[model samples]
Target: MLVSIELVPRSKEDLLRDITIVENILPQINVLNVPDLLRFDLRSYEAASFAYSEKKDFNVIPHIRAIDIAPDAPLPCVDRPEIKEVLVVAGDPPPTEQHEVYPNTSVDIIKRYQKEAPHLRVYAVFDPYRRSPKEELEELERKKEAGASGFFTQPIFDTNLLQLSMDWLRDETVFWGISPVLGEKSRRYWERVNNIVFPKEYDFSLEGNIHFAQRMLQLVKQQNDNAYLMPLRVDLGAYLTELQSFIVY
Candidate 1:
């Protein structure tokens, strides 16, 4: 199974620093996913270009927010030979309503990319928490029909939910997301803001998060699916070292 790491596009210096850290800590991890954050100055593809410049071997999958691009304009990353894939998302609204955005949905962009750039593999986002399993699966089917070659899901906290979603997407290429929630505040943010359903005995410490990630990775291995680590608000190197040790042993 291929493992990936999510890198936030903040600045050239920060992006390179994190890439180097991941390279030194876990050389096996070659896929770096860059998300498009409207609040940040650096666009996802720009940050991904920086990463590719630093390490040619890394498979950089930059996220393209459908709302940011017009229907007629070309994607900035599609022509680049180094970038073979992209993850398209509906994207959150801009921090302020002042920024102009297109009304395009992810499905619209996916279909357009498939027709316009057949060589580039497009991916769709799967949010299990936002809708019911039945509804989300139906929407995933819609994205699949739109010519999305694969999927990348939001972080799932429950094992049963993971299993169910994995079963639902059994034959597709999926990268299950895993992130660490360090404290009660972070936990509540997931619970209230993101609608994450955590188990009653969910661990809130660093070790607890590491153990859960290991378990998730093992399950993903058993199912022959890929997994991605989104180490939000944690020491990337240390957390990856621990997770890597689990894989090594």
Candidate 2:
């Protein structure tokens, strides 16, 4: 199985520090994905530079939201030889709605990339958390025809997700996302930001939350070979230890 970690954008200095920390654990990870947030956040390209600078062997996938680019114009980052894969989405609008909104959806972006930048691998985002599996497959099939070859999912806490992955997505590249909330503060953050009230079975105390995440991973490792960790702003030290121990060496 391949483990991919999400690297959130931050100040250049902090980002550089994170690169050092990630390098120590890079041998254990297959890919580092850089995320682009709603606000005028640090660009993923800057983070990509740090990954490329390291004289190491690993994959770096930077996200580029459709809201940020024009389809006809040149995409500087897409032209780079080092970045072979990109996750394209119709990014969230700014909280203040201040920025100029680009009128491109991810489908439009995918169609454009398929024709203009045929060399780059475009991945679509999928969220099967609250929805039906059949509907997710229907949508993914459309994306596949449009040019998306792979997908990254929203946080998952159920085994039914694994069932969908194993049954419908067996041939396609899938990265199952898991986030372990450190405590109530972190849990509340998820609730407020994503409005996700964890099902009672998956929500209890912090330990229960970690248990739920572990069970999700154990289920995933059995059926799939790719997983993405998306613990937003939660410290990863203990979580990494748990993952290293759980993974079969």
Candidate 3:
């Protein structure tokens, strides 16, 4: 299994610091959900430089937000030779802005990135439960047609939901399942932090969190031995460590 970490920095300095810490521990990690439309100014450049400096072979796959994909426009700066892969997401617009003002979809970005960076691999995000199985399959097909190399799902809590998605998409392309590690407090904290409204009946507990992750991993492995597991959230270190232990055994 290839273990990677998602870098969600609130600022350029924090991003650099996170990369520095990651470098000291692991050789490389995938930088997740980086906005492509942001200015490649001094601070952003410095953050990228520091990340690359830590591990020359580190794959700095920026999360290419869907909105940055302008129809027929030039590829973003992250498509440069230095970056080798990108995770394309239907990014949420900035809190202050409306998505209607955005120009492109995740597919458009994938198509442009594939053209500009022939060596770069494009990973698209899919949410199965959010839509019908047919619609999900159609979206996956659309992404593949637009040049997506792989698929990644949202933070999954139910195994059946994942199985349905995999059954529909198994023959189409490879996919990575998102297993988030958010303890009770952390989950509640993030819910508020992201302005996401949680169910009033939601129970936040460590046992619940671990059960969710373990079941998801089991289902993914059962469905396909080759399926890649991509756990989300910052506290996934424990889950990764446990996964490593299983591999060792």
Candidate 4:
């Protein structure tokens, strides 16, 4: 099973510091994913290129918002030889409405990439909480038809939800997302903003989060699927150390 870790691109210095931290848990992580935050000056592909050039074996996948690119324009990574993969998302609206955004959906961008940047593998977003399983499955099929190579899902706090999503997407390449909800505020953000459904016995401590990550990883491995870790606001090294230690391979 492949394991991927998500990183935010704040600045060159901050991104490298995180990469150095990730280096401590080498061999356990197979890929690094950089998200394109609108507020951040450094683009996801730029950060990914930096990491790709710095690391020898590790793969880098950058997120690109579909709305940012013009419908007729080619994908951003066409000239970036270092970035081989990208995740297409129906990105959040810009902080200011004065900023323009394209009307293109993720599917539109995926097809665009397929035609223009065939060398780059495109991954689409999957949000289990946004819609019902059947609806989300249909959306995923549409993405597949648009030439998405794989999927990266939203962070799942419930195992049952994870299993259902896994069962539904059994034949496809899926990176099940897992993240830590450290405090009450973070938990509320997930519940109120993302609409995540947590288990009744969900524990909100670091130890609890580590234990949940372990279980999720073990189950993902058992199903022969990949796992994506989004250790938001947490200690990446220490979290991975405890989580990866529990995995057999």
lDDT of each: 0.90, 0.72, 0.57, 0.88
User: Once model 2 is optimally superposed onto the true structure by TM-score, how far is the C-alpha of residue 201 displaced, in angstroms?
Assistant: 1.7
Poorest 10 consecutive residues by lDDT, candidate 3: 37-46
For every model shown, what is its TM-score relative to the native structure?
Answer: 0.96, 0.86, 0.70, 0.96
Q: What is the descending TM-score order?
A: 1, 4, 2, 3
What is the alpha-carbon lDDT for the whole of candidate 1? 0.90
- Write model 1 residue lDDT over 177-211, tens digit each, in one string: 99999998999898887889899989989999999
lDDT of 3 by residue, 145-172 (tens): 8888776666555555567666766775
Candidate 4, which segments miss by more than 4 Å at Cα?
A: none
Off by over 4 Å in 3: 11-50, 69-73, 77-79, 98-101, 172-175, 179-203, 223-249
Clashing pairs in 2: none
Best by lDDT: 1
lDDT tens readout by residue for model 4, 1-249: 888889898998988888788777756665899999979889999988888777857788999999999766667999998788999999988998876898989988999889888999999999999988789889999999999989999999889888988888899999999999998999899988888888889999999999999999988999999988898988878887888665555
Instruction: Indicate the residue-level lDDT of 67 in model 1.
Output: 94
Pairs in steric clash, model 1: none
- For candidate 2, report its TM-score: 0.86
